[model samples]
Target: MSNQLDLFHVQRAYSLAQGPLSNDQLYQSVAEAAGLASDALNQRCEIGRAKAKRSPLKRKIRWYQQTLKAMGVLRKVEGRRGVWELAEPTDKGLHQAPGRVCLLAYSTRLGVAIWGDNNAVFSHLDEPIHLCVTSPPYPLRIQRRYGNVAEHEWVDFITQSLEPIVKQLAPGGSVVLNVSNDIFEVKKPSRSLYIERMVLALHDRLGLSLMDRWPWVNLSKPPGPTHWACVNRQQLCVGWEPVFWFTNDPLKVRSDNRRVLEPHTDRHRRLLEQGGDTRVTHYGDGAHRLRGNGFDTPTDGRIPKNVMIKGHRCSDSLRARAAAKRLGLPAHPAMFPTALAEFAIRFLTREGDLVVDLFSGVNKTGMAAERHGRRWIASEIILQYIKTQAELFSQFEGFWLNPALAVDSPDRTGS
Candidate 1:
């Protein structure tokens, strides 16, 4: 049922490699680790694609290599263009090379993939990422364990953060940012223009183009019961947030509508069967143009609209609660739902593409990527958030996992 590929496995293989390897050598290592023949990677190359002239296998490996080189793990072997060698993970597993700083989490599930800090990590990536699905901690009203900038400065903070990210995108790659607007002035509930300001800054200052704006409709959202909604009743409860899609070049964005089509409505089926609804009606309030309530059916499911409805309940699962209890960790109160991450990933990227999430709390994006077969590089400042969630995605962990991998396990919470 999942329309995903094994991208996670490929990246994991690269991470676990003992030392620097040529592109062919890297693919063979990943393939062997994945329980496939060394030549199994050829299947990806056999299929031609509109976007990439190179084989998917080679492109995927190039991404892996760039990630390694950018992270200061690989370098051209003294003068060879194609040959490379490892420059990091000195026995201690901390990546202390020049131009890159920060100790790696050394996770088993895709070992050596979980990193920290975009400031230290992004500069190390030499290739453009295919997609980036992230739920950035925007300016919010409530205090959180994961910090955010003050409301007044949030727009600038978001814009500045994205500057590096934009440079990391592949030519046809896109970014889907999940951000919620806050009530900056409770006195003037609707006056929070920071989201708008952030959007403008991304476009005007950063030279990024807005591809589309999606409205995430969470039906199971809890009521805020704020002064305006519950007390004065001046505004309705805001149950939706914007998921903005951006790209370096809007004219050539990589998207597959067939990958994320919605089921056709009964009305659509019946109308096409009856060969009816050809009549036109007034279009909205203007009453100038005309349209029909129903029309011919789509061959498959209907093309999805920008308004995506998800009923994922906001409750801790028994497994999550139990893990939190056993590990002495608290569940992440503010985390992106797996379903939300799944939809964005399915819509924007293909199998074998490299996806990155800088804030990677609990790595919902990583989970989605694993299911869909995309390699992901997820990083979080807090090591425990990455550790506690590892159990949920155990298949991707390293083979010779460290016994002390749980060293950061105690008293860890807030994924």
Candidate 2:
């Protein structure tokens, strides 16, 4: 029932094209290598229908080219119809490039993207990072191909990757980690304690202080733990992930709630217009009191609650994936929403402060930083991801806004 587009075939075509290839040459190469239908490869729409539709496979490949053009990697040869030229060699199986760290790309006066393992990259970085925001691979029972570890080893893996970067944090710098909450115990309905264990490890082993745990609510999140949730009905669908905020020094943590405030609700606005509560009231069993004067003073905006709501889809990410498919490229397994990164960047760091993402999947953190006029650095291990995420900075690098806001501006893109 799910006819999802598998990008693997598209990426294969790019891998086979060592240099410029004619339309037929590239199509044939991909069809042969991927064992695609010869008819699908050679199928041509009628001249009238050509503008309206194309063979599904061919159309996908062609549309992907638009993505490549944006990334500045693939281009149609000037005056050579049906011919294309690759700017540089594509990732030959997504292997590491020859170097300790490679500066893959950058935005004008914004940020730098580097290709290398995060641990290795951070070791050589001399600049003190003001914020380290990232979502490392979750600890799942079965590790994914993108280098996530087994549940038992997840803590150690993250600890090692972050230990060096934590040492380099500025005095009041914060580390906000987006971690998985759906991990369950082996063959049971019980949840795993890895999150708690991770918190302890960071505090005990790294000497960091726990600041606050922000809940990222995604109501549109699909159901999971098929065996327990759908079959046995032992558990409910998990709709939120925990975002743990930590800092090197709790008292001096660099954050301001006023910077990331939520718009006032109509009811609250009416209350403010009426000149405060008008009467003193006691709530919480008389433990707390609300005075009329409290609502009389006007403020810029309401302080946002800790529960952040956003969908997973990001416009830039969608564009990157489409481009990646066109170029026959692979993507990071999981990419957090752009709004989430923007929230953290705005709340924790100031303009021109350095923000770093150790496990910069598709470099969403870097994109958020650049949009907010903050300096950024990203380190990702996969060369293909480095290439794919590089598309974010291709055009409108400094002036781009979070596209998620374009459609869902209220409630911060809450579904």
Candidate 3:
């Protein structure tokens, strides 16, 4: 049996403010209006309440209504009993109750509470994942020191390891694998094993297709060097890493072609007022039409390119060290920044869709999922890391950590 805190919160909020509308009713309403019965109006309300338990429920409901209305899922009618309803008739009744179970188990909102051996995740996931962003262990000799397999074994291991996950990925979904070449000696650089080989293996072996290659450049320099280099400085290394963006089916991947431009500076404005060409200052060569509220504008004056700059660093936590020692798990060497994960979540997923990280390291992806309001499912092979992540999320979000919340405490007081 799955937990129902997420579902109960959504249902209770809907019940208190408006009449209890069945999932079917909500679905039908959405389908009629938008041709897509899947709307997150109620789902968002549930997540908002789940996150902000200290806040008043009325405030949470207001916030939910506003968010959904802005997203064009809730419509306001002019009638005696005009109220917020689904924008269209839903083809299928709202299955939020069952859906919430899946989310609560591994959702991004709840954070990295659900983690353990790989089997724990496969059992819990009910639907195919839409997108996956992860940087698994690289093929390096040093990796073996941490109990990870040797470098030569990576190809076979990665291939066999991801087969089950690929099976669970939706045909339309995509996976972005970020990896880099490992350095062994100061002067000797191993033949750069192109990640394309793995991409090809997945496609030929598992039917996953390579869609794109995203170059992740770490602008910041790493401090100091290994045994090979006494103190390497400004090493003309291949700083850019490869992120193989693969999809089960190429057609479903969506790219938002919007850009955010910097406003004209005062100097440029003054020049424009003087009847100067001002074209270079006001409308740059690559300028495009802006849309949506100014707040949600995309960065970079152009649609985000495949190559994303790695500008953020991993979180620093002494607590993680303690937890690692207690749990007897090797420390994670590299973790993607929450900001990077957030970018991927926003660009790849809709508001309420599930975002998964197959190889969760230190729960960065989970934190990103919570920040962006996306449901997440993450799996970590190590037990210690899982426990540490669960504790961190429970303390930070104030959500019930135990999955037994459904049967152990139906009162919902823990939330």
What lDDT does each candidate get?
Answer: 0.65, 0.74, 0.53
Q: Write the per-residue lDDT of candidate 3 for residues 52-130, one digit (tens) a residue.
A: 4332323333444454455344456655242555443322222111111222233333444443344445545677676
lDDT ranking from best candidate downward: 2, 1, 3
Q: Write one digit per residue (lDDT tens) for candidate 2, span 307-388.
A: 8888887797787777567545675568888899999999999999999998887888988998898999888767567656
User: Which regions of candidate 1 are displaced past 4 Å?
Assistant: 1-101, 106-115, 274-298, 314-321, 397-404, 407-415
Clash totals in order = 13, 2, 19
Candidate 2 runs further than 4 Å off:
1-93, 96-107, 396-415
For candidate 1, write residues 133-232 as lDDT tens digits: 8888877777566666788888777777666777888887888899885455756756587778888888898787888888888867777546778787
For all predictions, the C-alpha RMSD in Å is 15.1, 11.4, 19.9
User: Each prediction's TM-score against the native?
Assistant: 0.67, 0.73, 0.56
For model 2, which pairs clash? 10-328, 11-328
